[model samples]
Target: MGRQCITEVGLWLPSLRPGVEEWQQMLSSLGQLYVQGVKVDWLALDREYSREKVALPTYPFQRQRYWVESSEGSDKTTTKHPSATASSPITELLDRGDYQQLTAMLSEKESLTAVEVVQQLIHLHQKAVAQTALRDCLYHIEWQIKPLDVASEKPSQDGQWLIIGGEVTVTQKLAEQLEQKQQSCRFVKELPQDYSELLQLVQQETELPLVGIVYLNCEEVTSHEEVLSQTETTCQSLLELLQALLQDESSNPTKVWVVTAGAVALGEHPISVAQTPLWGMGKVVSLEHPELWGGLIDLEPSKDVESQMEYLITELLNPDADDQIVYRREERYVPRLVPSSPSTSKTFKAEPTGSYLITGGLGSLGLKVANWLVQQGARHLILLSRRGLTEETEAAVAALQEAGNKVSVMSADVAEITDMERVWKQIQAEEKPLKGIIHAAGVGRLDTLEELTPEVWEAVLRPKVKGGWNLHQLSSSENLDFFVCFSSIASVWGSAGQAHYAAGNQFLDGLMHYRSSLGLPGLAINWGPWAGGGMVTAEAEEWLAQTGLETLSPELAISALEYLMSADQVQVTVSQNDWSHFKAMYALKRPRPLLDLITVAAERVEAKTEQAPNLQQRLEVVAETQRSELLRQILQEEVALVLDLPITSRPNPEVGFFDMGMDSLMAVELQKRMSKLLGVNLSSTLTFDLPNIEKLEKYIIDQHLVGFFKPETDEDQQEESFLETNLLAEIEQSSDQELEGSIDQILESIID
Candidate 1:
């Protein structure tokens, strides 16, 4: 068959050859010829290929393999379960109701995670097994649970230390004492004044592992220029040094202590005015990176250093120490919170004869203050602004003049020394002795730290720092009855985006102290946002409101100012805030110790949380038909509260809120109140977006209350949807007259 096929097909298979090597060589040569582009036809073998199917027997077979014997014990009954062997010691202690033992074990266990400890405590509390004992145990266990996985308890073995600006005799004495205690120390005596050079030095010095201590010694300034220059240089140096230290990974110091000789504790002290910035910056730096901050020590320059050395050394060694600010006394040092008390009287008198000079006096706040002065029996008033009198301010001035007071308008820049000098000369020429000065001239710029440039910072600081300095210098010997520098709460609690503004206000606070020390009458009022006027822009007012800051009314603010005029305190912060809301919003990033001062607010928040269901939960149970009416009442109440209007006089639904005297500050307050009441996250511009009560009500019902009232079943949901669609279709199909009637009915129901 193969030979016949080969002859017919002109092909032959390799099996036809007797020698295997010869046939393989022949096939290889043929394949090589094909690779060389030679096309070959089919090759047939000696035998023909065919396929056939075969049947198999169907049978099941059982087979088993022998298992290996256990390595330790051949008997399975002698072995224990894996779960029994893996039981945790913490679990055992907890199950035994031995909370004391559990806490001790947790404290000593190096391998146990904080999560495990927390879980055990939670389980014990949930089970209601020895509740009081578990609570006490949990409190003790909390101290062992570190927030960050840091080696906080580990002491630094490196003895080298870096001390900046400890050239003062007192600090030098302390340094000598530390050395005598066998501690190695190095002092950078000639501190760099420029920020760049200081940064470079910090980088170089921090490259090696060493603790850093910054000392801000009190220094006297000969002139206003010197005060500004020194303060600016010191602040810049500190800021740069902090930045460098934060970025240096090779030498992450356990703690950085900032020591200053100033009255940082809430009080009036005159000699350490320039040193106040250190305190403010120290506070903010600590908040920014609590892990790296050691503490802020404010020493009395005259106090002996020998007694405090032990406490200081303890603070340096203990990274987890709490008290951030300390002040020295005769025998011991203590922490202090700046205290503010109400004024003794509801009203106070201003100088009757001398003119009251108000910088930025043409602005809204300035004009209001002018009116206040006129009412306070001042006959002469000087209003200073860069653009002396715009059409609006001109009208205000005319009205003030009509009210039987002499109003003088000056076009001059308060920040410019020449402009300020020129104005001072004018005040002197008027023959009305400058009995009082209100340094209200300032600008507020909201920018993040990264966005702050030299120009932006200078713009904000110039009016406050330079203007305050100029006013202070020009009126130092004027025998003024009162020198009030209008500051802001930003200085007290650092605002998120107002670093420059806060720094500027802090300088004012410091300057007030300086004046107080010299027996000069001075007071710095750290006022919150003023309702209807001042440096707060519309955007700023909205942001402040959303953050739970309420604006002070003009009447209340003026009354407070009048009372403060006779108060003995040099610096006081005045504001009406919703502490619960403020804390919730502000503490989202991190906790603030300053907020602890608002004990009343904290108590109120706790009470609210315990006493009430949150707005969302309350709204969820309300019927859909009743929600619109409920929202209307809430909206009206909030509006009345914000606008300071009578609740009975609900404004016409068709009228715009802005037309009804709702300004930016009021709008923000209304938005916040509505959001809180409705349990909805409303926009800051809700009032603007909706424009009136009618539109706002419809928007709330449509957007927030859509699924607020959940249906009990799928059938109910479908029925509700069908009804809503049919109602809409019927309304669309109805005549214009019928639609008007339906709208009137709805409005009447909501309004009623």
Candidate 2:
């Protein structure tokens, strides 16, 4: 047992000879060899009774999830349309209302007459409409606390724990907790400035097989300046750790658990918003390299750890296939998308007196947000882009100006302080102060997990991570109405082939939370792909559609942005998908606990139907005098519950629902609550049309009639945003700034 003693274990004893007893624990070595599939002679290698004959399970013992491309040789550029889609046979039949043919095709009632078929189709339609309410809006995820029972001993507790962070007291406590369970942990208290050095540090620390890498190096960051500093230090450390771990594929997979105190608000606790971005980063890591990924744990925002500490140790050792876990005092939580509506905040309108700045303003999303600001009667709007305006962009700017808004296009790189400083100088020069900032400028690059080098990390991380910092730093002193960042759903839910993209958006989410924690006006909307423009490529949009996630149309996207201007929450993911189609992606792939929301939502709908009924009939039976007030009271309470406001708070009768804080979350909840109470199905947008208490009550009295709804759609046609073409072309034609400026002015004059 010369080499096998170190490589394979339980073969050599502590007394320098082959013996079974006397505190000679070679359990970690055996576990590493067993998991690695390196078979060892049991009786030959050790004493007869020393080795335990363990029972193996029918399913694989290794509980970690891994995903690969199941749809091999699939086209990224084309959407797979079935019979129900735009060009499908079902569409033609449905559009024409050809009930007889459809009934003949789908039903066994071939003997039925055309009239009967029509009657059957009408009945089917009615049935579908009544029950589709919850199914239509069940993908929204929120956090819920659930108790977990972790056993005293987990069978697969091998390898040493490596905690990478400062010598903070909480980290020390975590290490002690790990060792208490007879596990070894190493402390790498400092990280170097360079990636190679960071990699070297990991190599030196993990000579033996590693059980997990615990990252508890984060501190509470509340200011934008701290965001800049921490992005350089803290964010880089996490990236370096991941890069290093990927390089070293040890015998036993070394999973990473990024722990943060106050990174999340489980209940009514204040959060260390700066630490939240790591969740976004950790999500991508889990997706890109599931083999090296553990889950993310957020302890209660406190130092005195009791049961939360116990829960942490248990979760670190025995994660229940859940990637996101939170522990509050005596309570445990996992994330799931519950059927909550998009939220509404206090009503906020663009100020005519102050200027609004849109960074990356030349990009599609930025331009649209600028146009939206103009629609809100915003007088002076400044658009910041690093690139000189191209011909199409010039035309777009002219159109914005034609709408009687001062839309200035300034050239400045958001990541560079000097460039941002130049732009900031001009912004301060304005007669009116800058009121709001929308950071929409970012680049999208396609790289597989292996392709994500440190340079790639820098390129992708710089804009959102660094640019976000610059904006935060420059405007830290100003009283901004809204400091909105256009984060992406890629960060919230890990996207394939978008590792860097997810990381960047994740940084924005974290930055927003940090700002919000500091009592600043910050909101990060984790948006899905925009339909017509911005960073969405044809291939990407097709992929998104294939996954059942709809690309958010610009009109709809902007309306949401406008509505959530001052939303209560710092970070929120905004996207739409019917769970019917979206759940199929995960069917063959890895488990997503967040998607457990769809199940919960479905159960809730089932319970609602089974538990109670006939609310509307009961109201009619009551005196007509009290009917209006009762319905109104129900609406108020439901809205309040969804918004997380006081249950007693009521919406103003004259003010609009959105104005009184109604978003998709409140909207859907109100619809469900009303549907259950009225004993009839109400559309999800019941509040959207009947926006006030008077309108809502009137509609309720008049049989819960829904009003006309205009969908927020974008141009059917789409073009690639600046990252692919304009930015590159401008970089080559840098000497010709004069032509670009003249073209913009001329375009504006012609429009005028």
Candidate 3:
């Protein structure tokens, strides 16, 4: 074996830096060692020469070349230009409209580098396209394809998930569960507690790729003060945040889910009152922006946090789930329903021995309540108003005093804490302990969201939001028999042009719940528009009537309140609504969850829709003269209805609607009824516009029934013929009163 000198022959071992000759020599040495029967001890050999571990790259880059030709129809020679690198494979895919593959490449882990490169290219391309389109549209007077003109891409599912307002434990658990499922989540540890901060946060985070936002209810509050603070803070923050998010054009979150306590699902929980405003506002928010809402999830108090969180995550991740309001009970999550509960009586009596406070007491509804209280055996009543005494209010107060109830008129702004404190001091010093309170103070203005200025919003919120809070804080320890808040159906149904009003009333509803939780007597009544004495304007009333809501008679409303006072209920909606009519009006954009409570109306709406075309067609075919006649008849009938007179007593065609005892409310009702019946859009001032039946009939015929029919003779010719006719001779021969009587008789005969 050419006895290998141990010193000259290196040990047969792998080397970090090895040449081919060294490897050959090592092989020769290994052969010699094996032939000489030298048994190699593997464990004894030095292992220190092992390769050092190198840290793996965070992300691997695949150096694949991507390029595209500048011109699509170019020859092979034109494709060789170096400047052609402007377009990449990603841009090519976008140009070809293969978005699915692009989205897949962006989502797959193996193609992360490709995704970054593609995203940059796509962004550049989009910018170029947008600039070109805008420039062309603005300067060239040409129709161009703009960004919004392009088909919208489906929302990316890989964006960061946001968890807002959940308990620390529950949010943490939810985050862990999401991570386990390999989903990316960003937990919002703290949310803005004030409206300004909330608005700033929303503006700052408007560009974040937030796929979803899940809002959990705040922790339970123990004190009434805390309840009011937390509830108002949360609600205001939510309102501002939503307004910001909806207004954001850069990157609005794809979905928003509000998770609250199950008390709202059950329809009453005093401790849950602070959260109820969010529920009401959430419903309106969903209706206002259906595309951004995921759903409302209410977690049962008795359910385990871990399980509820698990179920919540599942629902949040699901894209096809239909239910918008869900309730978690024990082991399963189910859809929630706002079921109507039968009125139940509770043993309670209103003792009129002590003084009672009523805010907005000089308003129409307030006076009615004051009189009702007097009739109910209340002796002392303290009425508060910003405007202490008008002629109308003075007369009302005099009547109440004569009816044997001692009335004190106080002029103060209930929304002002100082004013409220002064009033409370005066009440305590001069009168008996306050036995009851009715918070009926509120202001309503109608304007679209775009027209809502901060001043207008604050004006509407002052009396309702601020006043309710002031009263609740001051009266928390009053031990009163009843703390009643006069809320409105706007909060329940979310009336158009009344967002602020609705939000303000919703806060009152929430405060009622909070009061109940403290074992204090509280009741919130959401009354419909009042027929006789209420703050509702004639225009607003007309709109409400068109939507199938009848004005509640003062007598009926007072009776309902009296009955509600004896019931063991925290909140009640007292309204005589025609669900069928309301549904028909909103058939195209009906609000869910709330509308789900009126399923019976859906069929009626469908039937109305099926019959609507036939009615329209019939009207379209009627001759102009006949159509005018039909409109005149409808006008007469509506006028009769408004006046509470027999249809046979229809007024003269030449007499003005106002002259026939048609006040603003009656005129509004007449306009509403005529508008609905004739399928014509009429303004609240329709009676004022034409004034008399003949002029209104002519205007309707010309504006709505034109081109379908024509008069047999010209207007001048008809007037000339009328002057020469026997009717003119009779009118000229008769006395003025007799002629007027004759005209009335003729009108009556025509209607009959």
Top candidate when judged by TM-score against the true structure: 2
Tens digit of per-residue lDDT, candidate 2, span 1-752 = 46665775444333433555434446555656667767655535555466655332211111222576587635533322211122334445799999676766555744888787676665444333322322232133477877665655557555678777755566677788888887777665566555456445555765656678878744666666675666556666777767766666455677888877776655556666567667767777776677688888887776554435677787887777688888766678888766544556576688999999998888888888887788576889888877758887999999988877888889888999899989889999889899999998888887766566668767887888879888988999887988999888778777767777876787787677667767888888888666775688876687666666766545446556655675566766667664544553432134566776564234133233322434454344334444555555656555666676665566567887677766544555666666666655554446655777788777765654333111223421122343447766764565445555767886787456
Q: Alpha-carbon error at 214 in model 2, in Å?
A: 1.7
Where does candidate 1 have its weakest 10-residue lDDT segment?
A: 136-145
lDDT of 2 at 22: 37
Ordered from best to worst TM-score, the candidate numbers read 2, 1, 3
What lDDT does each candidate get? 0.64, 0.67, 0.64
Candidate 2 colliding pairs: 141-337, 340-665, 341-664, 341-665, 342-664, 342-665
Which ranking of candidates, highest lDDT first? 2, 1, 3
Per-residue lDDT over 126-242 for candidate 3, one digit per residue giving the tens place of the 0 to 100 score: 434332222111100011111111144343365556677767888888878776765667676677555345434544664446667777774666464675576666665566556
Candidate 3 regions exceeding 4 Å error are: 1-159, 165-172, 179-183, 192-209, 250-253, 262-270, 301-307, 319-352, 447-459, 476-479, 584-587, 590-593, 597-752
1 versus 3: better TM-score goes to: 1
TM-scores for all candidates: the values are: 0.55, 0.59, 0.54
Per-residue CA lDDT of candidate 1, range 614-677, in tens? Answer: 5445443456654555455556655666787665445667788989898655665676666665
Residue pairs that clash (backbone atoms under 3 angstroms), model 1:
266-338
